[model samples]
Target: MKIFEIVFSPTGGTEKVSGYIADALEGEPVAVDLTDCGLGFRTVAMTKEDVAVIAVPSYGGRVPAVAVERLGMVRGNGARAVLVCAYGNRAYEDTLVELEDAAKGAGFRVIAAVSAIAEHSVVRQFAADRPDAQDAVQLAGFARKIQQKISEGDASEPAIPGNRPYKKAGGTGMVPKATKECTDCGACATACPVGAIDKDDPRRVDKKACISCMRCVAVCPHAARAVNPIMLSAATKMLSKACVDRKECELFI
Candidate 1:
């Protein structure tokens, strides 16, 4: 059976956690990027014999709306799935349950689940440099357990955390703005998962379209894009208490 690594990582943190797990699990996996809005996920069909690692970052204790939309279009065809929710050291809350529901609705069997820690996509200081060496070891260990389950032909669904009627999704207002150094390079626009940046100008950002994922700021080669410092500082201070401690990875199977 083939392995699928379906991921929605706009700022690379979620991808890193997912990669660590996939690396420890069987063979090389076929990659499926949910962040690419241009991809037609409806055509991504898999056989019942296949296994899939569906990973998405927890955005405000919930899954990104766009990731859910794209994942809905894909045909899982009864493939066994490992659900992973990578969070920024805070609680994932309803993220994994929501993701499990979405994956089941798309025809996947929920065989395993993981709650992992990663660096925050927006507030850089909170959980910074996460999915680090320690995280890698934890995730690899989780993957091995999942492999053992698969080897035993156990398809039991794990008890994932979160409530049904998930908590409301509050929007993050930390939109990044381009600085004077911007050369209209369009790199941010091209790399933006939501197409929130204007390709022609690269300076104009569609705030409504932006998911506050900080992808533009990370992608800007000239370091010309950034959120308001005051806003970032306030957010950092607000979340400091919750993110101060080092969190550990959790696996359910």
Candidate 2:
């Protein structure tokens, strides 16, 4: 059976967690980047014999809108799917359930689920350097358990947590802008998943289109793109209480 690693990681944190699990499960799984704007999701087709490790970052306690949209386009074709939601220390309220629903809709059979921790995409201090050594060991163990379940032909659907009607998505009005260090190299524009940055003028960003994914900020070679300091500080303060305590990875099978 083929194994596919399907992921949407804007700042690389989610990718790191997903990669560990995928590696432990399969030697060289096919990677399907949900962040690649050039990819045609509709063209991605899988069979019942294939397995998919679908991973996404939890954005505001739920699945990111872009990820949901992109995932919808692919046909799972009855593949067994393992859903993973990587979050910064805060709770992943509806992400796993929503992802399960999405994968089921795409013709995948939900077999397992995981809630993992990663460095905060915006508030870097929260869960910083997560999916660390400890996380790696935990995720690897989880992957082995999932492999066992698949081998045993367990068809029981995992009971993932979350409500049928997901909570209203919270908006982070925080948007990044170009700084003096910006070299107008257009790297951010090229890397932006949503085309929020103007290709011709890298400095010009469409706030309405921007999901505040921070791809631009993370990809900027000159450290030029950043959210307003005041806004970042306020956000950091708001999240501090919820993000302070160390959280561990939880697996459902």
Candidate 3:
């Protein structure tokens, strides 16, 4: 059976966690990058013998809109799927349940689910240096259990916890701006999934178009992009209590 690693990671955090799980599973999986603006996800098709590892980052306690949209286009064709939700330490809330629904709607048979921690995409301090050594070990253990379940011919659906009407997604109020160090390389413009950054002038950012996924910030080699200091301080203060503690990985099979 073939394995497909389908993921929507604007930054590298979710991708890193997915790599660990896919590697532990038993195949050289084909990668389907959901974050690529150029990809035509509707053309991705699979068979019953195939297994898929679907991963996405939790944005503000919910799945990103772009991810949900792209994932819906994939035709699972009765493929067995393992759902993964990677988030900053604060919470994943309804991400897993929502993902399960999306996968099932796309014709995938839900077999297993996982929730793991990764560094925050927008707020950097939360879950910093995560999917570390400890996370890697736990993720591998989860994969082994999943392998066992499949080997034993288990077809039961995992009971994932979350509310039916998912929490409303908030606005992308914060946008990363270019500093004096910006070289106008156009990398950020090319990499932006939404075309928020102006190609002719990299310094120009369209706030309404930007999802605040931080792809530009992460990809910048110059280390010149950042949000307003006042906004960042307030966000850091708000999330400090919830993110400071260590949150462990969870698995459902």
Candidate 4:
């Protein structure tokens, strides 16, 4: 069956996590970058003969709003899906379950679910250098299990982790402000999935539009953007366990 790896990664962590799973499956992956032009609006049309590994990072215990909006545009046509929610060692909370719902809504039949840990996109200390060697081995094994399940024609939706009511995780709502070094080169604006950054002056981020995925901070050539220091510190402190040096990936069949 044709395999597709659809991902929404701004800081490369989610992409790395998704890649490990895709590699193990030994299926030809169709890569769709959510950050790419018009991807947010265009539909990902697939057929029953295909399999999809849909992966995205958890932004504030939820799917990135832009990704949520964009994923809704896809049409899976009963294609079996393996949903993955990559997080920064912090709790995935509602991410995986919500992702399942979104993928199902997009016409995919949920077959498997995964929650992988990667380096924190916002809090630097957590899951640093993750999806590393240990994670790779585990993910490779996970892939084998999934391959077996698919071969057995087991397409039943598996029990995925997350809260039914979706535990309340407060939104950091940290607006990334551009620093003086910003050249107004417009890279951030162009890269933003929601057009949160102003193209004319990239420094000014429309907080209302920003999803706080930190794409602008990571992609900035000048390292010109930053979130609130106090809030970041508090968050890091609260999520220390999630930041502990845990092996990056785990496999479940």
Candidate 5:
């Protein structure tokens, strides 16, 4: 079966986690790049015979608002779907449920779901190099189980993770402020997945438009970007436990 892999990863951590899930499924996964600035709502029609793996990173325990906005373009046509939410070791609050709703609204039949963890999108200390060898092995086994379920004609929806009323997940509000090192090279603006940074002036960030995916921080050639120090300190204390546990990738079939 054809597997459509939809993702909105700016730091590549989410993409890596999604890759493992797609690899496990044994199909050529086509990426629906929400990173494209020109991206907007569009529909993708799929028949009952096909399947889709919808994956996204947990932005502050929720789906990136920009990603959610863009996902409205997908037309599932009642295609069976597996919702996969990858988080940065902290938690996936409403992200999974939101994705489930989005897929259903797009005409996809919800089947299984997974909540995996990767490195923190902004900060580098948590769960680095994740979706590593161990993660791949786990994901491969999970894929095999999912395949088996499909072959056995099991169509029941699995119990998704987390509570009904999702916990409050606050944003870091860590807008990466540009530093003197910035040459106004415009790379950060160009690489911004949500088009948050203005192309002409890299330092200028549209806070309302910014999803704070940290693409600018990661891609800065001169290490010219940084988040507010106060926010970083606050986030560090809040996420310390999460960083210590080294969360793992999960699978459900």
Candidate 6:
């Protein structure tokens, strides 16, 4: 059976965790980048003999709207799916459940789910250098177990956490702006998953469209993009309690 590693990672954290799990699974998996705005997700088709490791980052305990919209277009065609939600140390409350629902809706049979921790995309200090050695070991174990489940023909839907309605969608409002060092290279614009940055003038960002995923900030060669200092401080304080303690990855079979 073929394996597909489908992921939506803004600042590379989610992608890191997804990579670990995908590597631990059976064969070389085909990659489907949900972050690519140019990708036509609707054209993605999978047969029953395929398995998909669908991974996405948890934005404020919920799935990113852009990811949801793009994932909706994929046709799973009865493929077995393993849902993965990667979040900063805080929490992934509804992400896995929402992803499971989305995969089911897309015609995939949900077999397993995972919640993993990654460095906070905005607050780099929080959960820094995560999916570390410990995380890798745990994720690898989960992958092996999931592979065994698949081999055994276990197609039962796994029980995932979170509510049906889901928490009211929340926003971080931590938009990054270009600093004096900005070279107008347009790298940020090209890398922006939502096309929030204007191509001609990369500095001109559509605040409304920006999810504050920090893709632009992370991709900036000159380190020109950053959120306001005061806002970042306040956000740091707000998340301090939730991020202080190390959170472990959880697997559902």
Error of 2 at 71 (Å): 0.4
TM-score of decoy 1: 0.97
User: Roughly what TM-score does model 3 have, to 2 decimal places?
Assistant: 0.97
Residue-level lDDT of model 5, residues 1-253, one tens digit each, is: 6788877888888778777767777555666777776754474556777778888898777777777767777788877888888888887878888888777878888888888877887767777777688877887677778777777878888866665566575654678879989999998998898778888888899987777788899889999999987888888888887678877766655
- In candidate 6, what residue range of length 10 has the lowest lDDT sum? 20-29
Question: Which lDDT tens digits does candidate 2 get at residues 206-233?
Answer: 9888998988999999999999999899
What is candidate 5's CA lDDT for residue 172?
40
Q: Candidate 1 regions off by >4 Å?
A: none
Model 1 gets an lDDT of 0.90
TM-score of each: 0.97, 0.98, 0.97, 0.91, 0.90, 0.98
lDDT of 6 by residue, 1-253 (tens): 7789999998999989988888887865799999999998999999998999999999988999889888889999999998889999998988888898888888899999899999999998999999899999999988999889888988988789899899889854788999999999999999999999999998898999999999999999999999999999999999999899999999899
Query: Which 10-residue window in model 5 sums to the lowest lDDT?
Result: 37-46
**C-alpha RMSD by candidate, in order:** 1.0, 1.0, 1.1, 2.0, 2.0, 0.9
Off by over 4 Å in 6: none
Model 2, residue pairs in steric clash: none
